[model samples]
Target chain A: MRTELTERFGIDYPIFGFTPSQEVAAAISRAGGMGVLGCVRFNEASELDEVLEWMHENTDGKPFGVDVVMPAKIPTEGSKVDLESMIPPEHRAFVERTLDDLGVPPLPDGNRVDAGVLGWLHSVARSHVDVAMAHARKYGQIKLIANALGSPPPDVIGVAHDNGVQVAALAGAKDHALHHVEARVDIVIAQGYEGGGHTGEVTSMVLWPELVDAVGDRAPVLAAGGVGSGRQMAAAIALGAQGVWMGTYWLTAAEYRLGATGDGPSTVQKALLAASSRDTVRRRIYSGKPARLLKTKWTDAWDAPGAPEPLPMPLQNLLVGEAHARISQADDAGVVAMPAGQIVGRLNSITPVAELIADLVSEYQESAARLGKTLD
Target chain B: MRTELTERFGIDYPIFGFTPSQEVAAAISRAGGMGVLGCVRFNEASELDEVLEWMHENTDGKPFGVDVVMPAKIPTEGSKVDLESMIPPEHRAFVERTLDDLGVPPLPDGNRVDAGVLGWLHSVARSHVDVAMAHARKYGQIKLIANALGSPPPDVIGVAHDNGVQVAALAGAKDHALHHVEARVDIVIAQGYEGGGHTGEVTSMVLWPELVDAVGDRAPVLAAGGVGSGRQMAAAIALGAQGVWMGTYWLTAAEYRLGATGDGPSTVQKALLAASSRDTVRRRIYSGKPARLLKTKWTDAWDAPGAPEPLPMPLQNLLVGEAHARISQADDAGVVAMPAGQIVGRLNSITPVAELIADLVSEYQESAARLGKTLD
Candidate 1:
């Protein structure tokens, strides 16, 4: 499982895990794979700085990374208040009607919901990158910074390179990857349509090689999407990827099971474990983008005929934030929205991060050995 | 490139090419890869028998296969006339209006178009299968019989087995693959969303592994969809596919370029070469079912508002047969409907079948070697 990615990132394996939890990220780093904390959930620079500080303190000086959502085109380009005004009234009404129809109860008394759309807009995400870079400079432990939506801006790429951190961007198509390379990013994560979050129509088998043939020599291409096992990792490498960038597989890890409060699997984690690959649907019901998520009454309601089309980015996120908060507090499995990938079919159990990494390494070795025998 | 697929089929390579032209099919077999002749175009059993006889005489004792479209559920189980009667007048008017709007000229004088919808119905397809079985029984060189839409009927599978011919079926999902295995299919071609003709939403990366995990031990799985390069073949093999079943790549082969009468590439081929991967769309314009096809005026017209939706199976195919004849005769690239996968981006040039096979072999070896180095 050791490739140029392993040596470059100073990890035992080339598998990179993306998670929002600091504990899971630290566990992944400790297990010899790079754990990248998703910074999109953090609304303030102070919160992000705190998480980075926590990660640095807990991982025993192991290297990890941070991911921020920085789409090239933001729906609105001002303060969160201005972005909220851009959301259409009909879109907001539709979201409310859907939750009302689904019988998703509101948050418990006195639990106020935040109405502001925080992470998806350009200003917020740019601030996120700035804060992450500042924390990386102070801590010297963050080795990678990944832009989730599009190519990282030139200045951000420059700052990351100047700070000795590799910059990576997720591309669902070859053209996106070529643009990323042109932007001087050090790594390209070619995420396929089967991937959990934002994706293009191209699948991993086609997207990996197309990106590899287009820009593999220029940058280390990491295959993302439907990679839940060691054999899948071997396949990604064989398809010309230097490593694998996985997120959904780590959701059910033991570290994630023990949440911020040291409790067992979250409601979302339980939903993910019970899901089959076919259970997920790519719909714009949550984030205004076609993100793959668990098929719940929330998603189904939006898909029904006469439902208003979802607003773009910041607006859509704004419209759904309160509804999402309400559903989460209610904790009803039927209406809870859980973002996942087609790889969920293989995620039928929970294990420790170290054991998951070991299983991937062993499966990869066995697959390689089998192919070698055939070659012989 | 040798695997159990090669040994079982007695071919030098495990790659199987599916094409409607006998010339391309024979050329593929002559070049060491199995070529399965697509039999949907042949309306008459006599025409199919003649082509099979031609393939037998041209392949020089090499093995080949046959492909028949036998969808598990027929839209209409009655005769061609009864099915044609089911097509509404509005559907016929819409087809006429579309051809008129596209400026597709009528066929030349003395060239009468066949009005019968032949390939999609159960009776017609079953008769085609019976003729193929008879030919296979008569000629021992045909080693495989593939069902394009679904699992071959149990009796057909039994007959093929009795005649020492293997049965293959195309599956777009894991459940479909399991059904094929349950039906005792010797080979399951797990095609992804990127595949041509009919396909499910599951992409090759997800579909290949899911199908492999479900039925790899029960039956040999052939990875299909978006497989246009040797690196892709290596990826499929690593993902647990025994071999690859390819179609769109052969459409631009030199053999296809040199048509049955030694002419140039067909209008569809020219259109295919000029198009990008994004140019193809999965629509139910030509066939009643969703199939990936070139985005042309033919498909676009049907998608326009106020246009009548296409009728089911034989009815839709029947309604459009004459319109297709007019477009092909007119040689209008903009109106020509060509079934292709997202891999159209890589088919930039035409090459002979032998060179294509050699390139694939060399590329596979190179990719395997690179992975071997990483493993060390």
Candidate 2:
């Protein structure tokens, strides 16, 4: 558990839990791993600041982090209304027809669906960084800032460094890992194709070793994707990764709630729990960039013949944002737009965050011993 | 290195080396690993019988195996001429145009192009099994018979068992593994998407554990795909596989000669040696089934717009078999139709087969020890 990642981050294990739920994030930090609260769901700065303050109060002084979706190439800087206006009419019509076909009704009265992915815009992401930096400066609880899209802008990295918070970025390929290192990012989360969210084509078994060889000397590499058990964690370490950065495995954690609406174990979680490793598909429908999502009726509809190609980032998210909102509210497992990994097959139960971490450690130890026995 | 596989097969290690070259297969057996010779390239029974005889003589009584491309369902049974006549004119024109664009010359005037994939037919694969069974009865060197496509027809499995040889089938999904076990295959090779030749969508990291949970009690699971080092092998064992089955890592072995014509270090080998993990594409261009290949000009041509959709199974193989022959003979690295895995990135050297096996063992031990230290 005490790799360079743990020592550098001052955490008990090299495990980094990614969740949008402050409850789960706080629970993970309390259980001795770094809890990274995803900030892309927060469009307003004050909403994120309140969550950070709540995280500060609930995490019992344990270290936590914030993840922002700052695309390396800033896309269309505009207000939410302007961005909504930019979405094509045909794309909106397609979404409406697909939602109608799926029978996912509109949100109930007074439930306003804002434009999707407001945080993906550069302006909103900047506000996210400002809020995270302010939290780091105020409570000293925020220890890291992770850029989900790519390497953060230089000014953002500088602000994070000035606040004494490490900056980390996720890379799916060797070239991207090298680029992150060249940009002086602190740590590289080498995510493979089986990972949840945006990923590259290489599977973790190959990509981890390739990336470790590419940037292990410069920055510690954490294996992401295809990780659901301690044996998998052992595999990551065996492949030369310093630790594991897991997101999907935390979805069914007992402490996890829907980040946007704070609902516990909704139909999305049910669908994810019932999935197999083969139940996920990689598509651009989730975020415009190809991300792994549960292969439900919603994804299948988008992939059907004659379906329009997904739009570019932010635009695509904007088009589907309201559809996603309606689906979430509908609680229909068949059409949920949930981001998950191939590891969804292994999430068969709900356990406390503390117990899950303990099990991971114990399983990791047993796996190491089993491997030793093989060599002997 | 002793696992259920090593114990059952009486091999020194749990490693199974797959290669199409008899020389390389013999070297793997001689080096204390079970070498599985690919039999799909042998179009004639006499050719396979002669190779099995040579394997018996060259293996020094070490355990070896034979792999045949016997799809679970039977395809058309016809003469090579009939199969050739079935390929459409448009497909032929496409191949010609693509090869011409790549600057690959036609074969010499006397050299004959094949109808392609004769061995994929049920008759050819049955002959391969018969030749292998004869070898098992005579010299006892053929310890196993593996079906590359799926669970071999029940009769093939029964015949192998009658000859006192074990049968192994490859599966990529939980349902496929369950079907194989239900059909009473002796061993299951859980191949992931990162594997060479034919593969499934699930990755080794996730597929291994899923297959193990599905059929480990009835059959031993051998992890295949994305394995280039002993560390990857250790990862497989830790994921509950009894051993590792690897093929791509052997492509550049000094002893590997092109099985078709016994050529050494051809342009195909050169291209594979130069590839990165990212330099592969999973396309139906190789065999009608989706297989990973070096992302060369040939594969790219097939993927280009206006290219005809690849034909199904033996027909597709038939359509492109002559093109493959010409490409192999022409020695054009840029357009070679080579079936490789994502692990091609690691095949940078042409070490002898014996040295490669040794490196794997030593690396496995080192990786196991490293995991042990992490746990400590």
Off by over 4 Å in 2: A110-112, A259-264, B81-86, B110-112, B259-264
- Model 1 ranges off by over 4 Å: A110-112, A257-263, B110-112, B257-263
Every model's DockQ: 0.63, 0.79
The digit string of per-residue lDDT tens for model 2 on A1-376 reads 6788888878998889999889999999999999999998888899999999999999999999999998876454577787778888988998989999999998887465763468778888889999999989998989999987888888888889999999999999888999988888999999999989898899999999899889868999989998888889989998888999999989998877773345567687889888888899999988889999999999999899989999888788888888888888887888889899999999998788999899988889888888877656
TM per model?
0.96, 0.97
Top DockQ hit? 2
Displacement of the residue B94 alpha carbon in candidate 1, Å: 2.0
Model 1 error, position A347 (Å): 1.0
Best by lDDT: 2
Candidate 2 residues B205-249, lDDT tens each? 999988998885999999999988988998998888999999999
